[model samples]
Target: MKTLFSLFIALLFSMVAMAKDTDTRYYEMRIYYCHPGKLPDLLTRFRNHTTKIFERHGMTNVGYWVPVDNKDNALYYVLSYPSKEARDASWKAFGSDPEWKTVATESEKNGKIVAKVVSVFMNLTDFSPAVKAQAKNPERVFELRTYTAAPDKLNDLLSRFRNHTFKLFKKHGMTNVAYWTTIEKDGAQPKLVYILAHKSEEAGKASFEAFRKDMKWVKARDESEKNGKLTEKVESMYMTPTDFSTIK
Candidate 1:
């Protein structure tokens, strides 16, 4: 019996090791700014073809969304890869796929679908909750927030989020989706980007108001800024998941 128990313990350890090996994933956030009056065409292409092609090349589709306000004619999506090396290879293959080439050429026969493409590579922060595609609540409203840190203050900003802000956010009924720092190779600014899920737009506003008024948060923000402000500006957008979005 002791020997059997010992074997079971070794097997458990092996399984744990394997799980850890596969836990580190890299993500890419892509914003495709479609040409005026061509937003539907861009979304159609992804819904009908691009996402399948991505899966064929081993990319995991995390989510796809369109901003509720629609001010920029943009589509936002996230893709996950097993590793940075895997991401690079997958993209190279995806771009070279014959089906993709045909689809892109046909989609652009009238006019170019996209005006600009902004891509950011990101690694999940230590404190980020695991985001599962199947677990997302369809009724939840997702808020994407980007914070541009003041020069040389990116670390301070991260520290605040890691140590204080996230906790306060939860206390006020915010659901942390995921957090990431832009990859250096992507030439992204010194910024922190994260998504939060709220029960509704009204709930989102109420949560922020409560969070801002919390004494702990007020104290933390004041103390952190004693040296200098950590962020220069913050951009926020509320998004709704598309019908085919994996997360929604």
Candidate 2:
């Protein structure tokens, strides 16, 4: 009996350790729309100074990219934090850093570099692979997909991805970078956003073709929508890493 109790205690401790290791981390996805002809200045700031300042405040610079197919001058990047509290604290510190203030002041001496900024705070889904699990292929293309769920069907959409869609994606050779749902106050509630990596644009096309034809995925998607469609619309964009990006 004593031996059995010892084994139970050991198992409990093991579970606790695993839970701690897998603690949820928060992510911030920021999109910057550059002022006319100012994209270079914005990129220079991030490459030479902003990224280092972010690190000083405990923010993990995940990756930075510019859309391959976007006509507008836009930049997208991801940052990781241990928790929402940590994210808030770090941003507060980063905003107040004298160096950052100096950089911003000097960089925009002529005019503002950015015309608009959009930020979304996200929490990773339960099944998302770690950020470090990204593929090492330098030419890999990252596809960011944003889905707007039908009213009241957000949970249903998340369930389908959690249980069926992600597995099928992996089976078709797609690398799941990260999955996230925006925090409510960010304004786009009932939305699912995720990034996938592919060897190339042609590979991405082929993978999605196979993924859509997968019988399991078809059945799962159909069944989930019997009551009503899960997603109303999906927006997708292909992005390539900037030369100075941390992840590529």
Candidate 3:
């Protein structure tokens, strides 16, 4: 029993390390909730100054978007760093930069621009494509999806997506942008988050409806869940790229 327990410990750490892979780039997703009627000011600041400061601090700006409904007055964006340590360092520098401080103060002169902020750090999955900026496209809509894995079933969930779901999504007219798993500090539970692009919100919904009915997907999902369901919950949001977004 002692030997068996030791092997189990080793395997658990191995899996965690494989998922984190701190040596590689680490990504952060941030949502800024602006004060009512203050969102436009926040966007202007980011467009004119914040993005440049981020680049100066060695952060890679991935994409920025706002929800179609705008019900939450939130701005969502993703940033990447060379490594976990680099991410921390860059954020520290960004917070203290004189220009950033000035810009923040200026943007909020009328009133506090942001009411709240949420951030989640993540590691890119092996199956994720390299995220890159695209030429501006006014017609594209992006969907962000989050899936929570069932207890001790994270591997099974990842395997299913790796082996099957990714392909089916593209086949159904979805463009796989990137896939990530939240770092333990940010994700108390095992979870997967990914982005997909479609021609429009209508197109995105239609793609998923078709994807669900595909026999190949139905078979793969059933086979992967022989032990039990792989996910506990799923959340999806449709967003349009901001005019200044790099991924637009």
Report the number of the highest-TM-score candidate. 2
Ranking by lDDT: 3, 1, 2
- Candidate with better lDDT, 1 vs 3: 3
* Model 2 weakest 10-residue run by lDDT: 126-135
Off by over 4 Å in 2: 1-7, 133-135, 186-189
TM-score each candidate.
0.85, 0.90, 0.88
lDDT winner between candidates 1 and 2: 1
Candidate 1 Cα RMSD (Å):
4.2
Model 3 reaches what TM-score against the true structure?
0.88
**What residue pairs are clashing in model 2?**
none
> Which parts of model 1 are misplaced by more than 4 Å?
1-23, 185-189
lDDT of 1 by residue, 3-41 (tens): 999999999999998678544798899999998999999
- Tens digits of per-residue lDDT for model 2, 1-248: 99999999999999998787673888889999998899999999999999999999999998898998867899999999999889999999999999999999999999999999999888877777777624387798889999999988888899999899998999999988888887866455547989998998889999999999989988998999899898889998999988778778
| Model 3 per-residue lDDT tens digits across residues 8-105 | 99999999987675336888999999889988898999899999999999999999999988999999999999888898899899999999999988
lDDT of 3: 0.91
The whole-model C-alpha lDDT of candidate 1 against the native structure comes to 0.90
